[model samples]
Target chain A: MSFKKVVVFPAKLENLAAIDALIKSTAELAGLDARSIYAIRVATEEACSNIIRHAYQGIEDGTIECGCYSNMDSFTLVFRDSGHVFDLTGVPSPDLDSCLEDRKAGGLGVYFIKQLMDEVSFEHIPGTGNVLTLVKYLTPDSEKSST
Target chain B: MEYIVEKLKHCDLLSISGRIDSQSAPELSEALDKIMESGQHKIVLDMSEIEFISSAGLRILINAQKKCKQQLVAGELVLAAVPERVHEALDMAGFLPLFTIEDELTHAVGNI
Candidate 1:
């Protein structure tokens, strides 16, 4: 079976709770285990936070639409925002192996979103908006172990 | 998120609960900054009650750990009683090697 839940909120840090709740309930309904659910939650949070912090920076009244789509095969999240052109692909990876003082922290959020999700795609439409989609595949073994 | 800071004999203990996402990460950073500003570098972070931590939280932890290690006093930050889910998040971020982790708060405070 498949289902979807979506929420639209102003692209502000304060509204992250509502965004987190949306993803949590969707992941629970998909019968994900504690770890997978946490992964999805963190990935989606990172996506939304990036949108708010970077995409909507200096823009007024910007909004983000998050959709949680789940099925027997996979769980997917789609984020849409009408802010500036912020390409996550262009962001460089953080130097994880570097010493603490030499390491940088700026790109971890995008890196985490890519690391946690199974498949991710970003598309931008001219004068429309940017759509970022994250997917996590579901396995029967995973579903059974959670129960 | 909520935090309680306790000044122990060898190190300061900061107990944090609730989600540490982008919004609340600033608060965590502030709390750690205050502890370091007081010339105390050794810290034991009690994360037994933390339900979730995002990359934002991880950034704060790494930055604080760096400061604790590189500061003139040269102290370390120890994570204590980390929940399983939170531990996995740290592991996924490749952060497990950055700090010493203990299974109990008493052990973290005692060792640090």
Candidate 2:
């Protein structure tokens, strides 16, 4: 079986809770275990935060559309924003090996999205704006409920 | 997220419960800033009741840890009773080595 859910929210930090709730409920419906649900929540939150902070530059008037899709084998999240053209693929991975002195705070959001999701892609359409898709495969152990 | 600051004998204990995301991270940052400003760098962040944490929260943690350790006084931010899910998030971000993690809140405060 396949399931699809969509939600739209203003591109503001305050809407993150709503976004997180949507992701969590959708992941539970997709039969994801607690760990996998947490992974999806973190990845989706990171993606949305990137859109709000960088793409929109803290413009609360802007909007973000989130779509959740799930099948027997995988769950996916798609984010749409009509803000600046920010590409997650171009982000350099944070140097995790660096010591405390050299470590930086930024870039971890994109890094988390890339690390937690099994597949991630970002594209900018000429008129449609930025689209980020994150996919997490459902393993046998991670699928606790039936969808 | 909600945070309660307790001034311990050896360090400051910040008991945080609820989600720590981009929206709530700044508040947490401010709370930590206030603690650090008061010259209390040895902090025990009690994460037993925390529901979730994103990169935003992790950023605050790393920044706070750096500030605590880099000061001439050489203080520290210790994490205590971190839920398993948050622990995994920290591990994935390669942040496990950034601070000292304790399984018990009492241990965290006791050693700090």
Candidate 3:
């Protein structure tokens, strides 16, 4: 069985809770583990926060479209925004070896998104906007086996 | 997310329950600020009730740790009863070895 759903919300911090709840519910319906659900939620929040901070430049007036899909064994979350296009490809990876005092403040969100998800990809369509796709495989305990 | 701050004898204890993401991190930061302003340098953050934590939450913890370290004359900030999920996030983020973390709150408070 396959399930897919989408939602569009304003690019504001206030709407983040609703988005998080939606993703959590979707993950549950998909039969994902708590860790998998947490990963998805974190990645989605990073993408949404990026839009709110960089895309809208803190305007809080733009819109964010979130699309989620899941089957028996895996889940996917896609975030689309029609705002200032960001070059996610240019994001620098965090140096895990660096000490806490030497590490910079920002950039850890993208790093966590990269580390938690099984796969992460970004697409920027000039006229359309930015699309961030994240996927995670459900663990054995969370996946429904086919008889 | 919910956070409760309690005043200990020599340190302040902040207990965080629920998810700590970008949206709820500000509340934690504000609580940290209030504790710092109260001239409490020693702190024990009990994170056993936290189910999930993101990088934004990690950033706040790092900031709080740094603040406590700056104000500490002898020791560092203490984190107590951090759940496995939060521990993994902190470990992956290379922050596990930086702060003094205890598996029990009583041990942490007693050590501080």
Recovered fraction of real interface contacts per model: 0.69, 0.97, 0.67
- Model 1 residue A17 CA deviation (Å) reads 1.2
Residue-level lDDT tens digits of model 1 in A15-128? 998899989888999877677788889888899998998889999799999998989888999999999988896787887787677777778888888777778899999899
Q: Sort candidate 1 into its docking category.
A: medium
CAPRI class of candidate 2: high
**CA lDDT scores, all candidates in order:** 0.88, 0.89, 0.82
- Which is the better candidate, 2 or 3, if ranked by DockQ? 2
Clashing pairs in 2: none
Clashing residue pairs for model 1: none
Ranking by lDDT: 2, 1, 3
Misplaced by over 4 Å in model 2 are: A58-60, A141-147
Clash counts per candidate, in order, are 0, 0, 0
For each candidate, the DockQ is: 0.76, 0.90, 0.70
lDDT of 3 by residue, A1-147 (tens): 479999999898778879999999999999876777776787778878888888888464689999989986688898899888786646998877777677666788888787777778889998998988888877564332110
TM-score, candidate 1, first chain: 0.92
